[model samples]
Target: MRILLTGSAGFVGSHLVERFLGEGHEVVGVDNYLSGQRRNTELFLRHPRFRFVEADVSAGLPVEGTFDAVLHFASPASPPHYQQHPVETLLVGAQGTQHALELARRDGATFMLASTSEVYGDPLVHPQPEDYWGHVNPAGLRSCYDEAKRYAEALTMAYHRHHGVDTRIIRIFNTYGPRMRADDGRVVTNFVNQALRGEPLTVYGEGLQTRSFQYVDDLVEGIIRLLGVSYHGPVNLGNPDEYTILDFAEIIRDLIDPRLGIVYEPMPADDPRQRRPDITLARELLGWEPRVPLREGLERTVASFREVGEGRPERVGVDA
Candidate 1:
């Protein structure tokens, strides 16, 4: 199959590119490098099955060939990063998605939108089911990411509804693995970096905020299953195992360097107090469920971090 992948240089996109190529598919990857790293997909540049285009998905994306599938994974995902470019983030979710859907429609290709768990903002429900309408704040600092994803989901379903365009939506949970930006301000990266550097792990609020972590490999496998399934879905693709923020930090500490302690700080605005996915729908619908355990995932993540030194990144700040 010939594939077109947006955000193909991102942490997740790069992995997807490799996964597809490994399956003997020809892939054309497009990225703007705004949040994605060129080095992430650098190794695949020489592969005969891989082609890359440098362009921002929001402004415009022009591809020369028809594809068997189009995976739209563009958009800044982290809170600090997306908050820094709120307008671009929103545009990528809306306009970028529209462009992909149009391409899918024209070529009769499968379209997969990489939706996020952020759509369920500050979720009131304990374990978010796929049917649950989210509780999101429209005016919070995180709204750029949260609302944009909600709009993206709406756009995905709208495309499925109005045009009968074949579309798949995977609501991803917290995923971490190799190639993740060391200073991306996400919990797994932050805690792992701190532990490696012997710095204090930073804990937000009372550190009781619970979240589920999915290894990138597991997340990608679930994504492929959901996209390949015959039925359209706004399906939940995440690990259901839950842990508090502080507990997660401790687990990282124990895995990397047990002697390291933590530093407490106030939680960021619009940060969800809890998050866990109900995958009953995915299991019944797509036969997909996460198999990676949190500790095992952390061990692999720690090894990756060790391989890639935690160098100082350009100071990018958000109003969170």
Candidate 2:
């Protein structure tokens, strides 16, 4: 299948491009390099089955082709990146999603919107399921990303309902692996980098905030399976394992150096106290569940960061 994937140069997008290409699919990737690093796509530039286009999907998609699938993975995903460019994040989720949906509609292709666990902002419900409506602040520091994704999900459903376009919505949780930006401002990367650099690992609040981390490969697998299925769903694609921020920090600290210490800081406003996806629908429908263990995943990620010498302290300040 010929697939048009936006945000193809991002950490997850780059990995997804490789997966599709490896499966003998023709993939045309679009990215503006806003938060996505060009280095991530360096290896794929020579692949015959992969074509890269440097353009922002929010303004418009410049590529002209009939694709079998239009995967909308654009937008700044991390809190620091999205908060730094709030308007761009909103525009990409709203306008960029519309453009991708239009392309899929035109070509009769499967449409996939990469939504987020942030849509379940500070979730009151434990182990968020597909049915959870979420507890998001419409006007808050994180609202740009949270509400943008909420609106995008609504738009995707509208298209599916009105235009009869085939649509899939996957609410991605905390994902980490190689290719993640060293300064992406996510918990995994931040702790890994800090530990590697022998700096104090930063923990926000009392460090009781919880999150579920999924490997990128598992997420990509779930995505591929959902695309082939007939169900137009908002499935939760993430590992069920849960960990507190402090526990997670200790794990990373032990992995790198047990001597590394943690420093507490004020938690960011509207930060989710807990986040764990109830992937019952994914397991029942797609027969998908995460395979990588946290220890193994973290070891692999640390090796990748080491290869690129990415453990240095970030030059820019970011909220925790």
Name the TM-score of candidate 2: 0.93
Error of 1 at 115 (Å): 1.0
Q: Which residue pairs show collisions in model 2?
A: none
Q: On residues 1-320, what C-alpha lDDT tens digit does candidate 1 reach at each position? A: 99999999888998898899899999999988878887766869999989999888887778898988999999898877897899999899999999988899999899999998888887889799988899888998788888888998888889888989889988888788877877677788888877888898999899887777888998888877776777776888888887888988998999877888888988787564467889898889877788878888888888877766653332221221
| Residue pairs of candidate 1 with colliding backbone atoms | none
Per-residue C-alpha lDDT of model 2 across residues 1-320, encoded as one tens digit per residue: 99999999888999999899999999999998888877766769999998988998999999977999999999899877998999999999999999999999999999999999989988889889999999988998889999999999999999999999999999999899988888787789989988888898999999887778999989999998998899886999999898888988998999889988899999887564468899999999999999999888998898888777758522322232
Question: Against the hidden reference, what TM-scores do the models get?
Answer: 0.92, 0.93
92 in model 1: Cα distance from truth in Å?
0.3
Question: How does residue 116 of candidate 2 score in lDDT?
Answer: 92
